[model samples]
Target: MNAKSLVVIGIFGIATPALAAAPTIDQLIANPPLLNAEMDRCKHLGMAANDDPRCQTAWKAENKRFFGNGVRYSPEPVNIFRNTPDKLVPAEKQQPIPPAPAGAPHG
Candidate 1:
């Protein structure tokens, strides 16, 4: 084989082992139990897990599992706290002032 062919073959040989060792998408998606276990472990890791690629990937998988592929299905929001009243209250009637005391001085 030519030197170029040998070099190409060597690169593929090294990469094939690495690719085989890495998890496939099907493997990732098919094992929710394993993913849950991984998520628990990541959770226990606390703040450190934020910097971890494995935890990040696991979180992405979890989000996709729950939310689906970026599509949102949110329902219209209802106004539960609205202050609609069944009936309006009318203002109380005011009593007429009695004629000022007859002897009171006029302004």
Candidate 2:
């Protein structure tokens, strides 16, 4: 009701969520952070934790849940190449190559 009570309530609300957001040892061990694409790819391969034994255990447990499971996933969420055959422009359609510079030997 009062400003002091309102402020205290608001502070507690924020603090409660902040506390919950903090990672527990169990969570940290189960889902170790991927430091880079290489690490993520390792996870994608079910490597779990190559460097950390704890993560390895967690990955083993997670892998067990998919016994006999055949995974179906795309390569990645990124541009695989500059252009594919369908998207490529033929050489003749492209701009002509610039003429060789003066005194420059032709290739």
Candidate 3:
């Protein structure tokens, strides 16, 4: 065989394994057993699932697998200023600023 043919064959051989290793979209869609198995495992753990590290990890991974790594929606709007004490307490509740000395320049 020509050197060019041999090079092409070698490249294909290297790439074939990589291509085979990746799961296709169809394969992923068809894989319900894993999801069901994980659900069963977590279900069996019940309330104790929260304390089980392995169960927690599996649940998190399953959630990400199904929901994807996207922004989550909440029924209630998130308060960005939740941790800020100033925002929580109204300005009126705070001590009023002392008035400037009489005849003092407004500037």
Candidate 4:
């Protein structure tokens, strides 16, 4: 083989091990912080990221982390607004708003 070909082979032989040493998606997802950072990176990639395997894996991992085994957890509904009276809390037990001081500059 020519010297040029030998040099090219030598360079690839030295580089292949380094490339193999790179972590896989499972390894990256094992660490929560790393997974979160990867998710952020995927988010910044925007719509184009949907076609990226790394981004897809990161999103799936995040979904599993949040939703738990693909089952979505739906919490019971809560009524926070005062406009509607809540049946849960009895009106008698509810605290009454104290009357504003007489003639206090109206808001």
- The per-model lDDT (C-alpha) reads 0.75, 0.54, 0.66, 0.75
List the lowest-lDDT window of 10 residues for candidate 3.
20-29
Q: Which ten residues in a row have the lowest lDDT in candidate 1?
A: 18-27
The total number of steric clashes, by the backbone 3 Å criterion, in model 3 comes to 0
**What is the C-alpha local distance difference test score of candidate 4?**
0.75
What TM-score does model 2 achieve against the real structure? 0.24
Residue range 1-107, candidate 3, lDDT tens digits: 99999999999998777543433334443566755665687789889878866565566656667887677887777667766664454455668799986896678
Distance from true position, residue 83, model 3, in Å? 36
Query: What pairs collide in candidate 1?
Result: none
**Cα shift from native, residue 18, model 1 (Å):** 12
Instruction: Give the per-residue lDDT digits (tens) of candidate 2, residues 1-107.
Output: 99999999999988776533333334544554522333455566674357655445454544543342465666764566756653555575668789986996779
Give the better candidate number (2 or 3) by TM-score.
Answer: 3
Q: Where does the lowest 10-residue lDDT sum fall in candidate 4?
A: 18-27
Q: TM-score of the candidate numbered 1?
A: 0.43
1-107: candidate 1 lDDT, tens digit per residue: 99999999999998777533434334556798878877898999999999987787788777777777763755865556679555569879999988976786779
- Put the candidates in TM-score order, highest first: 4, 1, 3, 2
Clashing pairs in 2: none
Every candidate's CA RMSD: 10.1, 19.4, 18.0, 10.4
